[model samples]
Target: MISVLFFVLLGAMLGAALGYASQVFKVESNPLVEQIEALMPGGQCGQCGEAGCRQAAEAMVRGALSPAGCPLGGANLTQQVAELLGVSVTIADADIQWVATIDESLCSGCGRCYKACPFDAIVGATKQMHTVIRDVCTGCKLCTQVCPQQCLTTVALPPDSRSWFWPKPQTAAA
Candidate 1:
């Protein structure tokens, strides 16, 4: 009973020390970086020349990158990010929206496209018809390159009423 009591006390003491240390060494994230990241598209496509949106946000906060760095987010997101960062920015043309389409007749159900898709937008089983989840697809084109049957193709998505947004204003030549 005495040994059990001693062990309990020792455990409690260590727990208390750990809790105190955690409180004393708490790390706070920069709100600016969080805001910038929130404004990003979260595509993780590396189109911004960074590994991911969080890294891009950190770079933007550190003045090593610009708000226009993300092509996937386009001019609208750049404008929003620029406003949040208190910086003037020129908007670039929005990227063409693309969606993958799998020709069922040509699809061998090899599952290559499914395995290559980073977003899991392609859904099918081996020896079955694979279909592209258009809504979930980021149109990264990873599926097209990996399809052994060459059945996958990417096409520009026509904007519907719900998908349409105001076009960016064109600037005059300096």
Candidate 2:
């Protein structure tokens, strides 16, 4: 009974403290905006064809940007982002980035391209010939920058994996 009483007192004290702190440090919640913002491809690549993630965020909240804005986050990320913001979404076609395809037979084990990849998506040992993992590949054309032999080649989506969406219509004809 004594222990229970002590716990009750402690709980009451903590609750009071929390309530007081809340009044002192209140923050407005922008749940609707932040949720959609999180879905933006973190790459900040602007390749989403948007200016930046935050720009995309503003557009999303205003319902100006489509799920199509972010190329890296692609469909899955866009869908969740749209749901959270209570906005409509039209998923863009899958854009498989043209990642480097390592030709093992031609591989020199030079590790040159490995140095060029900023995303750390390539895997291999030094002087032991590196390999590209397509799933993680950003297809930035950076790795191809370092290859002296020019083995790495970018391939357009082979059509099997390609999908389509209504292109953002031109508002003003030039």
Best by lDDT: 1
Q: In model 2, what lDDT does residue 58 have?
A: 73
Off by over 4 Å in 1: 1-8, 161-163, 168-174
How far off is residue 36 in model 1, in Å? 2.4
TM-score for all predictions? 0.76, 0.51
* Candidate 2 lDDT for residue 106: 77
Cα lDDT tens digits, model 1, 85-137, are: 89997543444678899999999899999888767888999999999998888
| Per-model lDDT | 0.83, 0.69
- Assess candidate 2 and give its lDDT: 0.69
Off by over 4 Å in 2: 1-34, 49-55, 62-64, 92-99, 109-112, 138-141, 154-174
Q: What's model 1's TM-score?
A: 0.76
Residue-level lDDT for 67 in candidate 1:
83
Poorest 10 consecutive residues by lDDT, candidate 2: 157-166
Q: What is candidate 2's lDDT per residue for 14-93, written digit by digit as tens?
A: 99999999999998856766766665545555665567677787777677877556665655566677677666765545
